[model samples]
Every structure is written in C-alpha cells, then in structure tokens.
Target chain A: MIISVASGKGGTGKTTVATNLAFSIGADVRIMDCDVEEPNAHLFLKPEIEEKSIVFTPVPEIDEEKCTFCKKCAEICRFRAIAVMDQIVLTFPELCHSCGGCVAVCPEDAISEIGRELGIMEKGRVNGIDFAHGKLRIGEAMSPPLIRKVRSSVESDKGQLGEKNVGKINIIDAPPGTSCPVIAAMKGTDFVLMVTEPTPFGLHDLKLAVEAVKLLGIPAGLVINRADIGDDTVKEYARKEKLPVLMEIPFDRKIAEVYSKGELIVEKMPEWKDKFRDLYRQINEIGSVKSASHKEK
Target chain B: MKIAVTSKGPDLESQLDPRFGRAAYIIIVDPETLEFEAIDNSENVNAFKGAGIQAATAVSDKGASVLLTGFCGPNAFKVLDAGKIKVVNDAKGTIKDAVRSFNDGKLSFSDGANVEGHWT
Candidate 1:
C-alpha cells in the first residue's frame, strides 16, 4: 500500500509524521521523500544511502549545418527558447521547457535531443525501512522531473516486474503544495494522510489540498497536528467535508524541542507508536471499504 | 523578411502565451531593423514530459530569428541550440527597446549561461 503524507502548510510536521510513521511500520515499509526542492526527511532518519543516481531531462539541440533558414523550427516552438532567422537559429537553454515540439516540426531535421542533468537521487535503508529521495540541484526551478525520477527509482527497486513488492507499503513525504510536484508525489498512492495544523492558514491550504485529493480520486484522512493551540476551524471544516479525523497530536514544547534536536518522536515517545499504527490500520480499512464499494457498484 | 518576435502564444497564437514556459517569451525582433512583434510557437505534445522542453518546443515553433529574453535554463537552451538558434541573455526594458538595441548592435550576446535562481 502506498500512503502519501502531505500538508498544505509548510513546517507543519508533515515530514515528522511521515518519518515516524515509517519507523513505526518497520519491515516491508519504505519512506520516499518526494519534496525535491527541500527534503528534510533525511535530517531525522539519517539513512545511510546505499545507492545513488543522477536524474536527467531530454532537451532539444540544434545543428546549424543544413543552411536553409526557413525558420519552421522557431515557428513551432512555443517556449520561445528557439528562434530562427537569416539562416541562424538561436537557443536559450534556460527558457526551454523540453516539450520536443521543435524537433517534431523542424523541416530541416536540424533539431536533436540531449539530456541535461537535474539532480541526484539516493536509495538506501533506514531502520529496515527502504528509503529513496531526490535532491534537486541548488537553484533548480523544476521539481517534477526529479520527483518522477525518484518514483521511477522506487519502481525499479521494487523489482524488475514490479510484482515482487506487491504487498509492501511506501510512505511518501510529499511537498507542501497543491501544484504539480505535490500531485506527482501523490498520484499512484492508495492512501493520503494530510497533516495540518488547526490554524486558519492551515485550514485554507488544507481545503485546497482536499480538493486536489478529491480530484485525484484518492482516499485521504486528516492528521491535525498542534490540535490544541489553534481554534477548531480545521475540525469544523473536516466535519463539514465529512473527512475523517484520523489522529490529533497536541501542541507540545517537548515535541518541538525534540524535533529541533533531530529526534524522531516515535523513538522518544514509545506511546505514540501505537497511534501511528492505528492510523495505518484505519487507512487500510478505508482502502478495503473503497474497493468493496467499487465492486458492489 | 516576415520576421517573427518570440511571443507567449502557441503556433501562430503562441505570440500571445502569457509566459514562455516558466519565463517570459523570447522577444523575436528584427535585429537589423529593430521591428518587434511576438513569434508564434507550436503545440507542445509532451506537455507532461517537463516544463523546460514544453517551453523550448513552444518558442521554437514560432520561427523566431533571435531569442531575446532574460532567464532560462540548460534544457531550454538545448532546444534552441538544436535548432541553431542564438540566445541573447540579460535583456531588459520594453520588448521594442530590446529589439532596437539588438538592431543597433548594442545588445551583445553573452556566452555565459544564467545560473538557476539568479533571476531578480
């Protein structure tokens, strides 16, 4: 089962929940951090990555030898990264979106594709939990490709046929947004655990996130962190939306102080283990109900 | 010559695309005469492939003579280079003014690539 842990607000203990949850589940479990821009799961897990690989994206390369300045390639490129004039084709690599439409429309066949490295991915094991994450190169604006690369690495490690790890669970630390990166992280997951604080900003972003999950047709539950500090807006919204309040972790300085010291909450507080385990059970039950309802209909 | 200025539109309409890929359009203006207009690009088939490629494909379709814009990455450059297009980086001011600068040979093409995240 693939369970994606996501939050609409930043610094809301989303990573904390995801990492601790992975440790609680133990064997046959993995934590894939898909937030390529700023991955902090490693700060807590500190997994000694066993394997590493570079991620690349294909972009067009032009050959200026053909000599016909018809400018058809430029006419076809929507990104404006390519411009043809007076038999000269100018390229702006930074502006390219790599859609390959230029190569497809090039009348002179001068366009070719080349790969550009975006970032690196690490695959390893932490406390028996298989780990995979993408570290986007500093200053990289695009995170989807790196996210995709990490996802591909997960499938590859699951085995060549993708059937060997059919029953394993992958808990993903998704980015904090409703953009393409977040969507990419949550796409194929069987369950989504959205962590949010009880504040107004948290509620606002949570609504957007809920909409995204609903649009993706995925089962989701709410984990309200710092439940007591803020008002009951999230609870009110969740109740109105009929979203399950799976678990609530009260706002405590100990949790915050421990987090600052780079300590996993599950390791520090043995009592919370069972809570995460119960959350997992509830998620499984929700999945079963969904499938059962699908079959009945 | 039927010069095309790199606009934000796709195909003939790419001249109107609000932004080229992630960045603004590459103002495809006449370098010799400084006449500026947006260029029309083509449809990006692999819109899901990646944003860089999508932008490159979009701009290259418009038959732009020169890519005059600020901010872009290697992926976009590869597409422009593949089509034998030259890039003029760090271009500022109005699109027309940039074109005039290019026509007057005041816009010197920079060889160095813009490091990602350096844009103001």
Candidate 2:
C-alpha cells in the first residue's frame, strides 16, 4: 500500500510522520521524498544511497539547412518557442515546453530533440525500507520531471504495479502545497495522510488541500501535529469536511528538541511504536474503502 | 524594407511599444535609407513553442539580414545562426536607438546572452 503524507502549510511535521511511521512498521517498506525543491527526509533516516540517476527532458533543435524558412515548425508551436522567416529560424529554449509539436510540423524534418538534465534521483536503504528521493538542479523551474523520475525508480524494482506482491508499504513524503508539485507527489497513492496544525492558516490551506484531494477522488485522513499549539479550528474544519482525524500528536517541547537534533520520534518514545502501527492499519482500512468505491464507480 | 517584429499584441503599430510575452518586434528598416514596413507578429500563431523560432522566422521572412533585439536564449540563437541573421543583444533606449546601433555596427553578442528561463 502507498500512503502519501502531505501538508498544505510548511513546517507541519510531514517528514516526522512519514519517517517515523515507516520505521515503526518494521517491515519491508518504501519511502519516497518527493519534495524535490528542498528535500529533508534524508536528514532523519540517514539512508546510505546505493544508486543514483540523472533526469532529463527533451528540447527541440531546428536544422536551418533543411528548414526552408517555411515557419511551419513555428506555426505549430504552442509555447511560442519556434519561429521562421524568409529563410531563417529563431528559437527560444527557455520558453520551450519540450513538446514535440514543432518537430512534427517541420516539413523538412529540420527539428530534432536533445535531452537537458534537470535533476538526479537517488536510491537508498533505511533499515529494511527502500528509500528514494529527487534532487532538482538549482534554478530549474520545473520539479514534476524529477518527481516522476523518482517514482519510476520504485516501479523498476517490482513487477507491474498489481501483478507482483512486493508486500511492502510505501510512504511518500510530499511537498507542502496544493500545487502541481504536491499533486505529482501524491498521485497514485492508496491513501493520503494530511498533516496540519490546529491554526487558522492550517485550516485555510487544509481546505484547499481537501478540495484538491476530492477532485482527485482519493481517500484522505488527517494527522494534526502540534495539537496543543493552535485553536480548535483545524478540528472543526475536519469535522465539517467529513475527514477523519487519525492521529493527534501533542505539542511537546521534548519532541521538538529531539526533532531539532535530527532524531526520529519512534527511537525516543518506544511505546508509541504500537500507536504508529495502529495508525498504519487504520490507513490501510481507508485505502480498502477507496478501492471498493473505485470498483463500484 | 518590410520587417517582422515579435509582439504579444496583434498589430504592426505596437512594435515600438512593449508588453508581456511581447519580447522584441521585428522591424525591417532600410539599411541605406532608414525607411521601412513592419510586420507586427502579435497574433503569434506561429509562435507555438518558444519565442526563439518565432523571432528567427519573422526576421528571415522579412528578408532581414540583421536582427536587432534585446536578450535571447541559446535555442533562439541557434535558429538565428542557422538562418545566418546577425543578432545584437542588450539593445535599449528606443527602437530608433536599436536601429541606429545596428547600422553603426555598435551592437554585440556576448556568450551568455541566451540564458535559461524567462527574462524575468
């Protein structure tokens, strides 16, 4: 089962929930840190990376020798990346969408594609759980390519998604937002564990996240971190939205202290291991419910 | 001379003015007499992928041997090179200033004129 842990607001303990829960399971698991912009899961898990691969995207290259200056390639381009004149062609690489429409329209086949490296995908093993993460190059505008690369790595380890029972649970540490990056991280998950605080900002962004999850039609549960710091607004929103609040991690100075020192919570509070295990079971039940509903539809 | 200018808005008259995604307009001014006709590429129907190819085609179509413009990325530079159009970067002040700069042979292209992402 794949569970995506996401938060609408930053600093809502998504990484904590993801890493500790995977560790507590103590089974063959997989964890993916999809926050390519600023990945932080490695700090806590300390997994020894065993493999790495570069990610790239294809951009169009126009050949003026055969282009005939017809401007056919430019005319078909939707991103305004290609243009042609009497006999000359101008191209703007930055504005290019990497779509092959320009190449397809070039009557003379003047356009070819070249790959541009955008980021790296790293694979590691923490305990028995296989971990993968994405590291995007600085100044790279897009993150979805790298996130997709990381997800592809997970698939290479198993047979077709449902054909083989890898018998491992997957915990996806998603980026904080309801934007394209977050969606790329959370898609294809069996269930979503939304981590949020009990504050007004948390409630507001949580609503947006809820809207997104509903649009995707994925089952979701809430994990309210720092439960004592803010008011009851998040709980009220959760109740109204009909989303269940699964785990309530109280605001404790020691947990913050251990977290700041790069320590995992399960390692410190041995008794909470069962609580996390129960949380995973509850999450699995939610996934089964979603699967049944999807079959019905 | 007839020249094509790359603009976001649709019209030849908007070449002297700038707007978002407008980048630079192609104005085919006569090198000897400084008189010209301009093709305003505001419809940008052909500018599907990036501004680079659009600018190259506009310049080439206008029978322009020289391209006077602001900053450009590498992909567009390759198209310009393929078309054999001379490119001058960092042309500021006004369209007249840019034309004069081009005529005076004062425009130059640095190695990094075409960087990644948008001008912003």
Candidate 3:
C-alpha cells in the first residue's frame, strides 16, 4: 500500500509524519521524498546514501537545417515554446513541457528532443526501510518532473531494495500545496495522510487539500501536528467532512529538539515509536478496506 | 516603417501600457501616414507563461520593424532581436505621442531588455 503524507500549507510537518512513520514501521516500507524543491525527509531520516543518478526530462530542439518554416511546429506547441515567424524560428527551452507535440506535428521533420537536467535522484536505506529523494537543480521553475522521477525510482529499483512483499508500504512525503507536484505524488497512492496544524491558515489550506483529494477520489485521513496548541476547527472540519483523525502529535519541545538536530523522533523518544507504529496500523487497516471497495467498482 | 506600441486601449489616444507581454492591445502604426491597426492582446494577457514569447511572435509576424514599450523582458527582447525589430524602452506617452517620438528620433533603441523575464 502506498501512503502519501501531504499538506497544503508549508511547515505543517509532512516530512515529520512521513519520516517518523517510515522509521517506526517494522515492515517492508519505502519512503520517497517527493518534495523535490525542498526535500527535508532525508534530513530527518538520515538514510545512508547508497546510489545516485541524474534525472532528466525531454524538451524539444528544432533542427534549423530541415529548412521548412511551415509554422506547423509552432502552431502545435501548446506551451508557446517555439515560434516560426518569417525566417526566424525562436525556441524558448524553459517554457517547453516536453510534450513532443511540436516534434510530432512538424511535417518537415525539423524537431528533435534533447534532455534537460531536471534534478538528481538519490537512493538510500535507513534500518530496513528504503529511502529515496530528489534534489531539484537550482533555478528550475518546475518540480513535478523531478517528483515523478523520485516516485519512479522506487519502482525501478525495487529489486535492489528488498524482496517484494505483498504488504510493502511506500510512504510518499509530498510537497506542500494542492498543485501539480502534490497531485503527482498523491495520485495512484492507496491513501493520503494529510498533515496539518489546527490554526485558521491550516484549516483554510486543509479545505483546499481535501477538495483536491476528493476530486482524486482517494481515501484520506488527517494527522494534526502541534495538535494541542491550535484551535479545534481542524477537528471540527474533519468531523464534518467525515475524514478520520488518524493521529495527533502534541506540541512537545523534545520532539522539536530532535527534529532541529536532524534526528528521528522514534529514535530519541522511544514511546513515540509506538504512536507512529499505531499510525501505520490505522493506515494499513483503512487503506486495505478502501482498496478492497475500490476493486468492487 | 511600421512600429508596434503596447497600449492600454485599441485607439491611438489610449495610454501606452508599460508591460510588453501582458499588454491590453498592440497598435501597429505607420508614422508617415498616421494609419494604425489595433491588435487585441487579451490572449497573451491571460497566459500562464511564455506571454512575452507569444507577444514577440505577434509583433514579428505583423512585420513591425520597431517596438515602443515601457519595458521588454529578456525573452521578448531576444525574440525581437532575432526578428531584427528595434525595441525602444521606457515609453510613457500616449500611442500617438510615442509614434511622434519614434519619428522625431527622440526615443533610442534599447541596448537590451530593461527588465528580467517573468516580471509582472
């Protein structure tokens, strides 16, 4: 079962929940840090780096020698990446979506694809849990490509990680937001574990995240971090939405100290390990039921 | 020579728009005859990205040799350069006055784009 921990607001503790969950689970669990823009799960997990590979996405490159300024390539480019005006065919490489529509539409066969470096995907292991993350190249505007690369790495390198078990859990620490990167991480996952605080800002963004998850038609639960500090609005919102409050982590200074020092909470406060383990148990129970019902459809 | 001026409205009396990519309208003017055709640029104004590239493509396709605008980004400026279209930046007058400045040689071709790409 794949469980993606996501939050609509930044600093709501997606990495905290995800890393802790992976550290506590005594099963075949692989945690992928899909927050390519700022992957902090590695900071907490501290997985030993075992392998590294560069990730790339294809972008169009026009072959000027093919010589037909037919404007077809430009017309088919939805991103406005290329433009053929008179004798000049201008290509904006950064704007290209790499859909290859321009290459496919070029009757003169003037377009070819070239790889643009998106980021680097690193694979590692902490205890028995396999860990992977993507570090995006600085100044790269888009991150969904790198997020996809991190998720795909798990599938590609599954054999080397461990023997594939039926109950293997892949925990995805999704980027904060309900945008493309978040969707890319949460989509196809068995369950979405939404981490949020109890404040107004948290409630507002949680509504947006829940709206996104509802559209995706996936079963999701909430893990309210700093649960004791904020208002009860998040709890009320969850009740109204019929979303289960799976776990709650109170505002504890010890947890904060461990997090600040780039250490896992399950390692320092051994009691919290059971809490995280229980969180996984709830997810496993809920995820399997959701999947079983999903299959009936 | 034909010049393209980014404008807030379709007519020559309209104010010159400072933005190049998200301009409301592009006025194609003939300085010798004072004849102009207003091209609505709403399509580019709502673009998520590459608005400058699309706007530059429109100007290049319109056969304009000069572009009078308040600001041109690097991407639009590059496209304009490849089309050999001279860009005059920091334009603040009405469309009609901008044409007069172009004619009187008061406005000079900018060395490069005044602003970075993706600027509002």
True contacts recovered per prediction = 0.00, 0.86, 0.71
TM-score of each: 0.73, 0.78, 0.96
Ranked by TM-score, the better of candidates 1 and 2 is: 2
Q: For model 3, how does the per-residue alpha-carbon lDDT over A12-46 read when each residue is reduced to its tens digit?
A: 99998998898888568899999998888888877
Name the Cα RMSD for model 3: 2.3
Q: What's the residue-level lDDT of B35 in candidate 3?
A: 94
**Top-scoring candidate (lDDT):** 3
Please state the i-RMS of candidate 2.
4.2
lDDT of 1 by residue, A91-180 (tens): 656456678888888777888988777899999987888999999888666778789788777754422437757778888899998998
- DockQ values of all predictions: 0.09, 0.44, 0.62
Give candidate 1's total backbone clashes: 75
Provide the lDDT at A129 for model 1.
Answer: 86
- DockQ top scorer: 3
Which runs of model 2 end up more than 4 angstroms from their true locations?
A63-66, A90-97, A103-106, A156-166, B2-16, B23-120
**Cα lDDT tens digits for candidate 1, B4-105:** 234443222332222334543444455565554543233332343335545554555666646666655565566656755566666655555555666678
The regions of model 1 sitting more than 4 angstroms off are: A67-76, A156-161, A295-297, B1-120
